[model samples]
Target chain A: MSIPDTTLASAKALVAPVLDDTSRAQIRAERMSAFVRYTLLITVGFLMLYPLLWLVGASFKTNSEIFGSIGFIPQEPTLDGYRKGWETSTPYTFGRFFWNTFLIILPKTIFTAISCALVAYGFARFEFPYKKLLFASLIATLLLPNVVTRIPQYILFRDLGWLDTYLPLWVPSAFAGDAFFVFMLVQFLRAIPRDMEEAARVDGANSLQTLIYIVVPMLMPALISVALFQFMWTMNDFLGPLIYLSSVQSFPVSLALKLSIDTTEAFDWNRILAMSVLALLPALIVFFMAQRYFIEGISTGGVKG
Target chain B: MARLQIRNLEKTYTNTFKAVHGINLDVADGEFMVLVGPSGCAKSTTLRMIAGLESISGGEVVIGDRVVNRLQPGERGIAMVFQNYALYPHMKVRKNLSFGLRLQRAPKAEIERKTAEVARILEIEPLLDRLPKELSGGQAQRVALGRALIKQPEVFLFDEPLSNLDAKLRASMRVRITDLHKRLKDQGMSSTVIYVTHDQTEAMTMGDRICVMKDGHIMQVADPKTLYDRPANAFVAGFIGSPEMNLIAGRLDGNSFHLGAQSLVLPDELMARLRANSGSVTLGIRPQHLRVNTADGLRAVVAGAEFMGHEVVLHLDVEGERVVAVLPAADYADLDRGTTVTLTPDPGQAHVFDQSGGNISLSTSQ
Candidate 1:
C-alpha cells in the first residue's frame, strides 16, 4: 500500500534538481526514507508476531508460570499440558479432535481452492449469457452472512439426513466456492492480459485448456491465498459443525475442544489453556507452509499475505 | 500457409460496448498485413476476435479453408506476441517456448529441438534456463517472440510487441523481425501474419500493406509508400506521418488556393478536385515536401528550430497557422528563428481534402 519503490522512482524522476546544481537535500531525503522504511518494517514485524509468540510461550508454560508472568518466552518450560491435550481420556480428547478438524480442513482446503479458482476463471476469462448477472450474484453472496442462511441449510441437510456427516461441513463449502476467494482470484485473473489466454487459445486450446494451461498456472498466488484461508477457517470453525453434527465422532476439533468446559467439576483451567494452544497449531502450520505464496507484486495478486 | 479471410466481422460486448464494427479483409497465403491505429481504435480487438479470444457478435473468420468463427482459438492455428511479453513467471525461457507444444502432447525431443531452434534464432540459447524475471526487457521480448515463433502457426499476430522495448532495441528488433520474415519465407513457410501497432513507423517499415483504422473502422488499406504518398483521406494522411501532416484552412479561389494573404498555384490534377463549396476548404501537405523558396508561394516566418542531428525541423508561422519544414541539417545553416522565407509547395506531393476530410482526386478538368 505504501508503494515505496514506485514512489521513490517517481519522486527521483520528478524532483531532480538542475544539472549544475547540487544539494545536500537529496542525500538527506534518501537517508530519511531508508530510516523510515526500516523503522516501519521492524515495528510492523513485531506487531504481527508478538502475540503469537506469547501464545506459543504460554502453551509451553506451566499453569502457575503462565499466571505469574507476562514475559514473552516461558522462563521454565514444560510439555506436560501438550501431553495432557494429546490424550483422549483427558475429557478434551484432543488428538481425535485434531484429526476430526483435519478431516474437514484437508479436503475443504483443496476443494475450495480448486472450485474457487475454476469459478473465478470462468468469471474472469469467459463471456456468456447472464455473465453480469452471475458475477453480480457471486459478489452479492459475499456480503450475505452464513447465519442468515444457516437455519435453512440446516433444515435442508437434516431433510437429506446429512446432518451427522462431514458432507454438511465440507460439501457446501465446495459449491459455495468461498466467494471472497473467488472474487480475489477473479480480480487476479482479470489483471492478467487477455493476450496470454489468446496465445493459448490460438495455439489450439479450448476454454478449459486455456484455464488449465494458462490461467490457472498464472493464478498460483491467489489460489494459495484462497487455500490458506479455507484451511484456517475450516480448522477453526465453531458454528457449522456445532449445529449440524451431533455425533461425538463427527465433531471437529473446535467443537470437541469446547468440551473442556466442565459439566460436573470445577472449571479445568489447565486443559482449557492447553486445548487453546493445540488449536492454534493447524493455523500456524498453515500460515508457515503457505508463506512463500504470500509474496507481493509477482504479477498475480499484489497482496503481501 | 493459410489465407485469413474476415468478412463482416463485428464484436459487441454485453455492456453495449461495440469494440469492432463490421470489418472485411482478405489476405493472400503469406501476406504480411499490419493493423495500424491509435489506442481504442479496435485493431487489437479485431485481432482478438479473429483469434477467437473474443467472441464475435457478428461475422465470419475464415482461416485457410475453414470458417473458424465458432471454433476454439487453438484450432484456429495462430500464435500471438503481446505487448508486455506475458511469459510464465514460474517457467524458464525454454519451458515458456515449449508450453504450447507440451500442451498439445508433442514428443519431448521435438519440444527440445523446437525450443533450441527458437532460442538459437533469437540468440537466447544461453538464457533458456533463466526465468523471465531475470531477463531484461529486450530479452523478455525475444522470449515472447521465440515462444510464438516455435509454434510455427499458420498466422502470427503481433500486438504492439515492440512498444515495451527501448528505442534502440525496438529499431533493432524491427530489422530482426523483418529478417525473420525473409528467413521464414525462404524456408517455404508462407504463414499469413497480421501485426497490430500504434506506431506508424513500425507499420510503414514492417507491413506489406497497412490497414489504417479509426473509431473501429478501417479508414484505408494500402502499401506503405502509397499510404505515405497518396493517403485516402485527411485522417490517413495525418495518421501515417510523424510530426504529423500540417493541415491548414484555405480557400479554393480559382486555379490556385489562397492561404491567408498568399496564393500557390495548385497542380492541374488537384485544381479539378476543388468543388463549389459554400465555405473554406482545407489544404493538406507533408512537412518534408514543402521546400523553402525565396520567390513563390506562402510567406512563412520561422518560429522555432529543432535540430534533430541529421535533420533540422524549422517551425514556421504562415497565415496564423503553424507549418514545419524538415530540412537536411546543412540546408538550415543560414536560417534562424524569425527568418522570413517563402515556401514552395510541390503540387504532386500535395493531398487535397474537402471539409469532410475525404480525398478528392483531381481529374485535370481544367
Candidate 2:
C-alpha cells in the first residue's frame, strides 16, 4: 500500500487536532504517571518473586555455588540434585513417598468432602432437635485452637494402637473433624434456595434423596473447593505426620523432605531444594487448575440471601 | 381429583406467635380458590398448610375423605409451583418435568410420555433440552407449571408463581394460568388449585372465588364480581379495586352523610343500616363511581389529573379530603389542575361502613 498524496504538514494536522497547552500538559503528565506506576509495579513484583527464583536456581547449583552469592543464576546447572533427591538416603524412593502422600490425601480429601457435605446438608435443610445449638457449636469449634486438642487426640490414637499408621491422619476426616469445611459447605448449602429442596420433597423424594439429587448437584463447586482445600492441606501437613508416622517407610513427602536435611553434617541443600520444588508442584498445579471453582464457591457460598 | 377442606386452620410459631389464626375454608373439587391479601396476611401460610408443607397448629386439612394434616407434603398428593419458579437450575426442562414422576418409581416410558404431553401442552417442547437459567422468566414459569402438571396430583398450590415476571409477562401469564384451569376442567382433571398472591388483580382475574385475608384473619370469600361489587368491609373495599375505594369518615344524620363541609344523601337502604349503627361511618366510593362536573354536586378543587390512556384519574380535594375520581378521557381530557368541579357519588354504588369498618350497608338479602 502507498500513502495518499498529502503533505507531511497536513498528515500531522490530520493525526492530531491542536490541543490547548494545559490539555497537552495533562496528557503528558498522565503518560508519565502511568509509566512510573508500571515500572514500580514490575520492580515490586520481581522483589516478591526473588526468593522463589533463588530456590529454583539453587536447586540446579552445587552447594558451593549456592552459598557463593545471593544471585539466582547458577554458575553451573546439573541434574545431580534431582537424581539424588529422587532416590534419597532411605530404603524407599521419593516415588514411594509421593504414593504415600497420595494414599493419605486422596482418601482424606474424599472423606472430608463427603462427611462435611452430609453434615452441612443436615444443618442447612433439616429442622432437627437442637439444630441451632449444634450449628452454633460447629461454628464455635472453628475458633478453637488445634493445639488445644492435639495432645488428647494423640493420646487417644496411641491408646487405640493406631500409632505409626495413616489411620491417624485420615480417619478423623470421615467424621467431619474439619469444622472449616463443614462450615463452608453449610454456607454454600444455605445459599441454595429452599425452593429446590421443597420442590424435591413435593416430588416424593425423601430427605436423603433430596440431599443426593438436588442439594448435592447444586453444591458441586463448593464440594470441589472443599476437596481441593483438603488435598492441599493434607499434602502440606508436617506436624501431624511427624507426630504419628515414625517409620521412614510410611512417611509422606512433607516428612520425607524434612528427613533429607542433615544438620549434623553438610546438608544437601540443592537436593533438598529440588525435592521441595517437586513437592510444591502438585499443590501449585491443583490450585491453578481449580482456582476458578474455588473463587466462585467462596463468593457464591458467602452470599447470605 | 379431590375436595380440600381446611377446618379451623391455624399456624402458631414457637407455640406463641400466631402467624395464621384459625380460619375455615372449603375448596371444592376442581375449584380455583385464591387466597389473596397484603404481605404478612398469612395467605402463603394458609396455602402451605393445605399443601402439608406447614404443619397446622390447630386444624384439620382434609383432602377427599382423608384428613391429611399428618401427611407429608408429597403424601398429601399436592404439587406446588413456588414464587421463584424453583426450576432445578442445573436440570433441563424435560428432567424438571419428569423428576416428580421418576421419584414415584414410574416406568421410564410413562414418565417420558407424561413429560412430553405436558411439554406439548405448555408449548415448551422446543425448550426441553435447555436449562432453567437459559430460559426467560416466562419460560421458566411455564416449566414450573409443567413440572406441577406432569405430577397429576390431586391438588395444585401456587405461591405467587407469577410475581417474579415483568408486568407484561405477568398479565399474559395470568391469562395462561386461567386458561390452564379451564383446560384442566375440560380434560376431566378435577384438581383443586389453592393459589396465594398479594396482587389483587391476580386474585380478581384467576380465582373462581377469592378469599380476602388481613392480619391472619379471613375478611371475605367471594367470586371476583361479588368481591368488587359487595366487599364485606372497608378493608376489602379498599383492597379489591384498582386505585382503591375512597373511604371518607362521616356521620349519618337522617338520610344524609355529613363529611366535613360536603353533604351526600345516603341511599335509603344504607341510611337504614347507618341509622341502626348510629355512629361515625366510613363512606366507601369507588373511583369510577364518582362523577366530576360543574353542575349540582359537592364543590371540589381538582388538584391534579393523570391521563391513563382510555381514562383520566383526577385527584380532587373535596372538603379537605383527598378523593380520586376516574373519568372518561375523551370527555374530561381538558380538565386542568386547580379547576373547581362538583363531585357526585352514585348512590347505588356507594357503601357505608360502621366505625369499626364492618360494611353495615351490605344488605342481608344479597
Candidate 3:
C-alpha cells in the first residue's frame, strides 16, 4: 500500500475522509446517549438529595432564617436550634426521648434478629407438613396494610392494660418474627446449595445443627442486612409508638420529633429540624456502620421483594 | 463402613414426575459403585435417595443391618460430596471441616484433630483459616470432602464431585479420590461407596462396578472392564468410550449378509441362531476393534485420520458407513483419506444385540 499524493495542507483541508453513514450515525448516537444519561441521572439525583440537603441546612438555621426562605445555607446561621432541640425543649427532653427510644429500639432490634433468624431458619431448612403454606402465610403478612393490624393489636394491648410501655413494639418481635426479614433470609437460605447441608448432615448434623453451623453462617450477609434494615425501620417508626403509647415520658425519638407537631408551640421549625437531624442519627449510624454488610447482604440473596 | 443396598428405590415429586423409577442395586463392602448416564437419567436422584436426602417414594435403603428409610441423612451413616463442592460460603475451611463434629457435640480437641488430619490429607492446611470465597475451586472441593470425611460415615456418596473442577484438576482429583478409596480399603474401612457421574472416564477409572443407566432404568451392571468390553445395550456400548462404539446396519439373507452393497458371511453359530430365532439383530463394534490394514480383509474407504501423539483415530468409510477406528501411531503414520483399505474386526471383540438393544449370545443373536 502506498500513501495518496496529498500535501499536509490538503489533508488538513479534507473533510475528515467523509465518514461513512454507519460511523456518522454511531458517533451522533453515542453523544446523544451520553447527554440523556447525565441529564436523567443528575435530575433525579438532585430531586432525591434536595430535601435531605434542605433538612441539614435548616438544622443550622435560626427560627427567623428558617421561616424566611429555603436555601442551601442560612444567611445568619445559629446553633440555637441545636441547643433547644438537644437540651432546651419542653416537658419530654430530647435526652430522655433519646434514652427511651434507645432502650426500646435496642431491645426491639435484638428481638427482631433472634425471632427473624429462628423463624427464617425453620422456613428455610425444614420440610414439615404445611411448610409451603406456612411460608406463604408469612409472606402474606407483608402485603397487608399496617393500619389493619393497629386496631386489633391496640385492643389486645388495652385488655392487657399495657398502653404506655415499650412492651407493645418490643414483645411482638420475640414471637412471630418479622415476616419481611424472614422472607429475605429464606431467599438467602434457598440460594445456599443443598450440598452444604447434606455434607453437614453426613457429618452428623441434624436439622437444628445444620441451621446453626452451616446455614446461618452462610446467611450472615442477609441476616446483618435485615438486622440493619430493622434497626433503621424500628428507630424511625412513629405510627406504632403513637397508637400504642399515651405518655410523653415513654415516647420514642420519632414520637418526640413529632411533639412539636402536636403542641401549639409556634411550629418550632428550628427545634423540629434539629430533632429531625438528631432522629436521623440512628439510621445514619446504622446505615454507615453496617453499610458494607448491608450492601453485601442485599447484593447477596437479601430478598428485596 | 458397611454394605449398602438400595431395594427398589423410587422418587416421585408432587408434580407427579417420577425422576427415579424403581431400581435395585447392591454395593458390596469396600466396592466403588458408579451410577453413570446422560443428564436427567436420575443417576444423581438415585444417589440422593441412598443418601436419605431425597425421600424414597417406595422402597427401603438398607445399610449394614439397619433399614434407613425413615432416618435423617445424619442418622443414616452416609456422607455425600456434591457436584458443586457446596462448602458453606461464610465458613472457613477449618469451620467447614469441623461443622459436623461440632454438630455432634464432639469435644473441641477431637474435632481439631480430625479437621487437621483431613486438611493434611487433602493438602488444604493453609486454607483452614480462609473462607470458601478465599479458597480456589480445588481447595473448596477439598474442604467439602473434608467436611464429609471428618464425619466418618459408613457410606461415601459422590455426586460428580469432580464435575466442577477443570479438566487437569479433575484428572488430579480423580487420582486423589481413587487413592483415598484404596487407602480406605487397605485400612479395612469397608465402606460401600456409590459415585454418580455423567463422565464415562470417571466411571471407568474409579468404579469397581459401573451401573450404566438411561431414562431411570439400569442398562447394565458390570465391572469397569466388562462394562467397556461387553456393554449390555447400544446405549452402554456407545456411552462408555470417548470416540464411542460404531454401530453399522446390516441384514441377513441366506449364507451371506448384506451391508450396503457388500456381502459378508456370518459365523456358523450366528447363522444357526438366525435359522432358530426370529427378527433382526444389530452388530456392535468398539472403535479400537476396527482397524484398516493393507492385508486382505473387510473392504472400506479411508475417510479421515486424527493424529494424537501416542495414537491416531481413523474415521473409516466402511461400505458408506462412517466408523471410527483407533490405531497405534506407527500404523496410522501415513494413512491417507479416500484410499481403499482392508478392514478387520478382532474376533470376539464385537457384541451382538437384538433390535431392542439387548445383548444376545452368538448362538441366539437373531
Better model by lDDT, 1 or 2? 2
Best by TM-score: 2
The CAPRI-style docking tier of model 1 reads acceptable
Rank list by TM-score = 2, 3, 1
lDDT of 2 by residue, B45-160 (tens): 88888877777899899998899988888898899999988888778999999988888889989988898899999999999999888999899999999999998888999999
lDDT, model 2: 0.88
Q: For residue B169, what is the lDDT in candidate 3?
A: 96
Ranking by DockQ: 2, 3, 1
DockQ of each: 0.34, 0.61, 0.47
Model 1 error, position A86 (Å)? 4.0
> Which prediction has more favorable TM-score, 2 or 3?
2
List model 3 lDDT by residue over B169-203, tens digit each. Answer: 99999999989889878888755789999999999
Cα lDDT tens digits, model 1, B1-366, are: 599999998888869988788999988777889999999999989988887777899989998899988777777788888888878776788888888898899998999888888999999998989988899999999999898899898888888999988999999999998889878978888657899999999999999999999989999999998888878788998998878898878877677778877887776756555555334677888888888865677889999999998898889999899998888887785687888998876667777788888876533432
For model 3 chain B, the run of ten residues with the poorest summed lDDT: B270-279
Model 3, docking class: acceptable
Which regions of candidate 3 fall more than 4 Å away from where they truly are?
Answer: A1-65, A68-78, A87-92, A119-140, A175-178, A261-268, A302-305, B253-256, B268-278, B291-299, B318-320, B332-336, B342-344, B362-366
| Every model's TM-score | 0.83, 0.92, 0.85
Residue B236, candidate 3: C-alpha displacement in angstroms = 2.3
A128-190 per-residue lDDT for model 3 (tens digits):
899989888888999988878888989998899888888888899887557888887778877
